[model samples]
Target: MQKYILFTVLSAIFIVFVGMGIIVPILPIYAAELGATGFALGVIVAAFALSGGLLQPFVGSFSDRHGKKGFLITGLLIFGLTGYTYTLASSVGHMVLIRTLHGAGSAMIVPIAMAYMTEISAGKNVGRYMGMLNIAIFSGIGAGPVLGGFFLDLWGRNSAFYTMALLSFLAAALVALVLPGRDSLTIEEEQGSMLSVFARMLHHRKVMGILLARMATMIIMVPTFAFLPLLMTRHMTASGTEIGMVIASRTIVNALFQMPFGSLADRYNKNRLLLLGSTIISIGIFSVPFAVSFVTLLLLFALIGLGEAISWPAMGALAAEEGHLYGQGSMMGVFNTAMNTGIFVGAMGVGALVDVLGIAWAFYLVAGFLFSSAIIAAAMIRPRKKTCISTGDKS
Candidate 1:
């Protein structure tokens, strides 16, 4: 039953992400079609991210106090239902509202699922579990664009949303049947309120640094994926399918490298992996602005994938270790909020900049932020120490 629940929950997460991935390449185009300006598009993207970011901590905390299974079901149902509304959106406002709702559902689902996973998996193998979870996520992301493009080709834009809706519904049904009802962590109010807990986590030098690193990594990523199609179309004369291929290439590389990277994290200094990944990501982001050809763009994105493969799992493992004292759910909530906020800021800010300055400048700006992140990451992380304990020889 435990194994069934774990696989089923993971599958649900994978399917939910498929819906997210399928929309990635097409969303900006949809916004443009709805008469949205670049700034408007940025706002539209940010709205969803912001809503998710703001709600995640609360949802995670609530799940910790109450139970994960209920929130999981509620979230999945909302995700499935709200996903269908994207097809009905006639304006950017409608799209923004629906997207925000969709993000709210995601906030409930992701952190709660993560908390559940932490409970189910043994402490020593947490990184391995996280790697497996990421496989599900990246696989969904990898397949989403290809599948989305195919559906769009066959049935058009509305078909993409309808397909996503169906997937979400199927995932929800799977979760309802297979996920066991279990509450893993006990909540102690004396540990602190949510705000205080967040503040305390922030005060921990390593925890804070990890959060910032996560944010920086995501900030670079959000803009790259968000605006890649626009850049491809405007600069390289690429079609939607070609753009999807470029995005798909990144995910393929990410999936390929995640497990190996996770193993490396277990064996070596995880911080080094974090540094290496961030540096690689920065370089990839920096080079993306100069990618004038489709092949060049694909190669650069693959490098970005490699960077992500190293950074994400290592970071997750590190966070798990740091949060060993705190409840995993609370720490994960904080982490999710940081990540989602970064995505919000990156997407909205870069989208606005693209509108004002140009697409090239936007990519360059993201690259700069990533480079800065690499520097900060190196400065912040240190080697873990081992303590030797001894007993008296005489009895």
Candidate 2:
């Protein structure tokens, strides 16, 4: 039953994210066509992150008490609708409204799915389980960009958006028809109110470290995802396929490395591993402005992906370990909220920086922030203590 649940949940996630992946490279270009400036682009992405970040905790707490399947299904349906709605947008403001709605739908999906997966795992080898989930996510995302590029090049922009809608709807139907109506594990009513739980979590050193690390790592998204396409267009005049391949490189590398890094997370000092990964990511992002060719950009992005692959399972495992103390749904909600908030900050900050200091400086600033956060996270995460047997005779 657990295996079945994992498989079903992962399938739904992969399908849904493939739809999301399909739009990633295309969204900036589409928004650009609607006269969106760098600030406007950031506003659009930040809107999604802010709305999703705000709603995630509440949604997670609600799912903890009620059930996860319903929220997951509803989120997928919303994604589908949002994809189609993109075609109807005439201005950046319209996109912001649409993205805000899309974010609400997002608040229901990934963190809820994470909670459900964690619950079924029985808290053992959590890194491994999260690695599997990441595989589904990264693989779907990896595949989507390639297809999105193809669709855009051959069938035009609307075709890509239409495909996103179709894929999301299919994912929703899969979850509705295939996944169990309720999770195998049950949550007790005495888990406490959301505010109290959050207040307590905020004071916990390890949890705070994890949240900060997550937020800091995510701060690079706007510079990488939202601005990279623009950079490539202006610098290299890269084709859509070329752009997709560059983005896909990072995701594919991350997906490919998940299991191995996840295993390492279980065996090593997770905080140290996370710090190492973040440093690598910072270096990669910092080097972006120096890339003179498409190949260099692809390589740099892949390097970033490798860094993420190392960091993600470690982060996921830590969150899962913490989940036992503070309801899985709530913990993942907080965890993902940190992620969204990071993106929100990145989008707004980087967008404005691009307007003032230029895109290169924006990457430099984000990279600096990531490195600083990584150092702080490493300092804050508690090291595991070793157990030893005592000998009667003294040496």
Candidate 3:
């Protein structure tokens, strides 16, 4: 029964993400066709991320005291309804407004769900469990573009938008019916403010180092993927199917490899793997500007996907361990905030680069950034001297 509940919840989450993912290869082009400039298009992507990132900490902190289920349900409702709003957007402003609402909904769901999972799966092989969520995440996202691109080829933009709306509503319905309501928020007044907890987390060398590495990971990812499709379509004369396949290649590799690497993280030195993975991703990103064929680009994306599969599961295990020590919701909030921040900054910044320097420069600059950030992470994120410690918390 518990297994069924878990599967249902995960499935619900995955379905909604398929909705979200369907827009990936389509949205930027849609915005541009609606008379948005390069910078405006970047803002379109960044707006959602900015709202999501900024709201996550506060919402996560609140959920720690209130209940995750309420926020999860409410957020999914907003998320579901907002997809239809995209079809109605006539201006960049309309898109931004819808994106802002969508971002808020995103902030509430994933991190809170993560906190719930981490808390429940205590003392288990957390990496493997958390990595399962990646399967749902990647598969939904992977499949979304494939279907979206097909719909675009057949019906047009509105069809894809409507599909997104339908899936979000489906996810909302599933969660309402299937997921258990466990409002087990056990916060004492003496535990200090969320700000204070954040301050402590900030000062903890291990936590901060991990956080920095995670932040860097997203900084490299968000911009590259956001802009790569644009380059593929414009420069390579790629079809929607080709573009979707190239993007989905990464997602497919990510979904396939997560659990295996996650299991390995339980037995191996995760910090080393993180460093190595970052380096591999850098290689993939740097090689992108040189690819002239669809097959080559697809292989490169797969390389990046392999790196992500290797590193993220390890990162998740470490994050789950830390969330247990601090406050689960708070830590997961910060963890997610790092992801959104990267999306926001990377989208905006890379958009500017695309406008000013060129698409090639955007690729080159992000690759350099990825390599440099990996170096810094390798230098900073050292393992603790003692092993098998009960708590991953540091003061």
Candidate 4:
């Protein structure tokens, strides 16, 4: 591993994510504390995703042409600034406006870092490196909630915000000192206008296929987060602690297995892994109605986590390889856009579905949609075709 590039980037990302996690579990309650109603609270939560989704592609394309470090540093600063200002938000409306800007900061950071990661890593190890990067995310996700609870209990709300601000500042300073300056633009990426660049990247059938699958994967995943707790508590009589345990189990599995699964993507058939992993996730989701017992429910959620561990490394590897062929930053932007869009659409759309069609049918619809996408992914990106598509890497 290149300690300066990979380790430093990972450290910055992990710390940023910890800040993110610290705010997430408490944001709604904090909004209510500020007199936000249900709909207002939803708006406060969605603001970040709305802004992030809109900005991610542009940030990515620009970074490819100019440099990643500047945007990365700027994003961290925005995040740190937002963390500090969070202490000043007096009402729900204030938080919503601040959170919207906060989303842009979040958008700018991760994809560019991903592009930089690919820029520095060996081609053969893209999957492994990406998997390693994901650990920072997983660790942050795991740590954030526990820490959020602790901070709220002990240090108070304002202290958590200050601590988060401090972490983001530390992250920014580390990246500024450690990572290299501007990257040289790739020949393939440098030739086109912004609109044309996106057109060319999206024109590839495989890119569309992979991106759609990525979106669909998030759709399935989000519904679990949105609806599962409701079902567990309302029907199964599961306690809040039990519900949290089940959720944490998924995060733990994902964090633990990402590296091993990433290693497998490097060593074996990526499409086969994608196929198998999606199938496992589908199985877990489709059987959710049957998870009557607490232990059984936990196992199902674990299966979903296991499938995520197996599947996402391959998805990320393919995206990086495409970025190598076309444009690293732009392609990563598209990938991130797919993620945010999925979170937004999945949460809203499936929440609607649950009201009209009922939970069982909602799970089936999402699972079926997700399961079929694996076929599209496999059919569109064949092994030989994948090799043939790399016209030339001019990096």
Highest-scoring model, lDDT: 2
For all the candidates, what are their Cα RMSDs to the real structure?
A: 4.5, 4.2, 3.1, 4.4
lDDT of 1 by residue, 1-395 (tens): 65876788789988988887887778888888999877787788788788889988888776666778888888888887876898889999998999889878888887877776666665667666677777778888888888777776667877888778888889888877776566533442445677777777777777877888878887865666667777887778877678778888888898888888877777778888888888888888788888878899889989988988988888888877765556677778778888888888888888888878987777788878877876786566663454475432110
Which pairs of residues clash in candidate 2, taking residues 3 or more apart in a chain or in different chains? Answer: none
Clash pairs, model 1 backbone: none
**lDDT tens digits by residue: candidate 3, 282-378:** 8888899899999999999899889989888888778878776677788888888888887787778888878888778767777788778767766
Ranking by lDDT: 2, 3, 1, 4
Candidate 3 local distance difference test against the native: 0.80
Q: Residue-wise lDDT of candidate 2 within 22-140, one digit each (tens)?
A: 88889999999999888889999999999999999889888888888899989999999999998999999999999999998899999988997788778778888899999999999
User: Could you tell me which 10 consecutive residues in candidate 1 have the lowest summed lDDT?
Assistant: 386-395
Candidate 1: which stretches are off by over 4 Å?
Answer: 184-190, 383-395
- How close to the true structure is residue 244 of candidate 4, measured as C-alpha lDDT? 52
In terms of lDDT, model 2 sits at 0.89
TM-score per candidate = 0.92, 0.96, 0.93, 0.83
Model 4 per-residue lDDT tens digits across residues 53-157: 789999998887777888999999999999988989998879989989898998889898888777767576887888887888867766665576567767777
Error of 1 at 156 (Å): 0.6
Candidate No. with top TM-score: 2
- Compared with the true structure, the alpha-carbon lDDT of candidate 1 equals 0.78
Worst 10-residue lDDT window, candidate 2: 386-395
